[model samples]
Target: MVSDKMFTYISRRLSSIKQTPLPFGGLNIITIGDFFQLRPVKGKTAGGLMSTLMISVSTRVMLIRNICTSDGLVNGAMGLGVSLSSIQNGIPIKPIEHTFMFLGHQIVRSQFPLMPSWACTVHKVQGLSLDKAALDLGSTVFEKGMSYVALSRLRSLQGLTIIRLDPYKFECSDEVLEEYSRLRDTLSPHDDV
Candidate 1:
C-alpha cells in the first residue's frame, strides 16, 4: 500500500498539469476500500498483494510480524487457510519494505513475509513449540548444537518421526549442557543468563 507521500506526489502532478494550486488541482477523488485494509504495506503491491505470495486458502503460513493487536497472532506465529487470509489487519499480505539506492535513485520494494511452515529449516522453527516434527538430520551436520535445536523442538519421541537421525553423525555442543545448569541455578546472583 502507498502512504501519503504518494498522495502528495499525485496532487503535485495534477496541480502542475491543470495549472491550479489547489490540492489535486481541485479534482474530485473517491477513495475505496476499508480503512484497516487500506493502510499502506511496506513494499508490496497495494491491492495486488495476493499475486506476490501466490497463496491459496489452503496454504499454511507463518505470521512473521508481531501484530500484538491480533488474536494472539503475532510474529513467529503460524495458522491455517482462512485464519491467515481473513486476518482483518491484513498482515500476511502486507509487503516487507526494502529500499536501496540504485544509479543515484532510491528504489523501494515490498513483499509478503509468509513462509510455508509445513517444512522449514531448524533456524526458522527456533523458539517455537511443536506438537509433532520430523527430524531430517541431513547427511552432514555443519554446526554444534544444530541437532539439539532440532530435536528439542518436540516434547517426546512419541511426537517425533525421524527421517534420518544418526546420533553419531551429529553432536550437540557442551555449552548447551553448561547453559542448562546455569539456568537451573536460580539463586546465583551473578547469573545474567
Candidate 2:
C-alpha cells in the first residue's frame, strides 16, 4: 500500500511537472479501475474488523462475517440489500432493522455483517475470486506482477472487461529473472548422463 507520505511526495512531483500549485496542481487524472478510487477508502475504525458501511436498497453486498453460515451467509457471499432500517445512532455503525432474502429465505438481523462489493482497488482484490472485473492496465501499473494479480481474480473471461491492455504493464523485475535463472541452472541435468 502507498503510504500517505509517499502520496504527498507524488503529488508534489506532479505539481512540479505541471507548473501549477502544490498537491496534484488540480490536474485532470483518470484512474485505471473506477471513479470510486478517486478518493481513498477509509481505514478500519475502532471495531478494527469492519469499516463504516454505507448501503441502500438493492445494493449488492458481500457478507463479511460467517453470521449465518448454514443459511449461506458466510464470509465473501454476495447478496442484495432489500431493506435498511433507521440508523442506531447518528452514525451508521449498526442498523435498527436489516432484512434480506436469499434462496427464497428471509433473514432479519439487528446488526448487519455486510459490505459493498461493487468496486475496490487492485490491492484489495489480491486473494479474492470475484465474479466480475474490469481492468485498464494502460500506463497505470507500477509494480511487477500487478497485471497478473488483477487478471487472475476473475472466475472466467466472461466476467472480465479489459478497457485497455498495455504490454509494458506485464514487466518482471531484473532481480526476479536473475533468481529464476539461478534456480534453473541448479536443476539442470548432469552432463555425465
Candidate 3:
C-alpha cells in the first residue's frame, strides 16, 4: 500500500521531470498491486521501487465473543471492516464504524481500513504464484533479476502482460548473452558433445 506521504513524494518527482502538473495534483495515481493479500495499517504506508506493505491493523474493533474457534474470530481478536457506515459527530461527522460478522456474532469497530488497493514490490511477491499479472516496467529498472522475478510469478506466458516495457529493459550484457548462447548450444540435440 502506498502511503499518502510516499505518493506525494513520487508525484513531486514526476512533476519536476515532466515540467507540468500531474493529475489530482499528483495524487490518486493508479498503479498495480497484489490486491488479494492483506492491506497495511493506517498512517504507516508502504510501496515504492523497493518497499512493500507492512501488514498491521490500523483500526480498533470490539470483537463480540462468538462460539466459532476455527476461524480465529474469538473474543478480542481484531476484525477487518467488510462494510462501513457514514461517520457522524464532531466535524459534523458521525463516529466511524466498521461492521463484520464472526460466527454469527456482529462486531463493530472504528479505525482507518487503509486504502483498498496497493502495488506490492517485487521482493514481497516471491514464492507466490499468480494466475495472471500485469507488469509495469517503466522506462528504467534499477535492479538486476527484477525482470526475471516479475515474469516468473505467473505460471505461463499466457498469464503475463507487460505494460510500458522499454525495449532496453530486456537487453542483456554481451557476456551474459554469450553464456546463455553456450548453454543453449549444449542443450541442442544437433550439437556434438
> lDDT of all predictions, in order shown?
0.60, 0.60, 0.47
TM-score per prediction, in order, is 0.53, 0.48, 0.33
Per-residue accuracy of model 3 over 1-193 as CA lDDT, tens digit each: 5543454466557767767554323334576743222232233111111122223333334332332457654433343433344323311112334566656888665533232223555554543677887887765454544566667778988988887686556544454455345446434476443
Question: Which residue runs does candidate 1 get wrong by more than 4 Å?
Answer: 1-52, 83-93, 101-105, 174-193
Q: Model 2: runs farther than 4 Å from truth?
A: 1-52, 63-77, 84-113, 190-193
Q: Is candidate 1 or candidate 2 better by TM-score?
A: 1
Best by TM-score: 1
Q: Is candidate 2 or candidate 3 better by lDDT?
A: 2
Residue pairs in candidate 1 whose N, alpha carbon or C atoms collide under 3 angstroms: 1-41, 43-110, 44-110, 65-75, 66-75, 96-111
Alpha-carbon RMSD to native, per candidate: 20.1, 16.9, 19.8
TM-score of 1: 0.53
Write candidate 2's Cα lDDT for 84-116 as tens digits: 655432223233344555468885555466678
Better of 1 and 3 by TM-score: 1
For 136-182, candidate 1 gives per-residue lDDT tens digits of 88764456656776777787788999888767756644544543453
> Candidate 3, after superposition: displacement of residue 172 in Å?
6.8
The alpha-carbon deviation from the true structure for residue 81 of candidate 2, after best TM-score superposition, in angstroms, is: 2.3
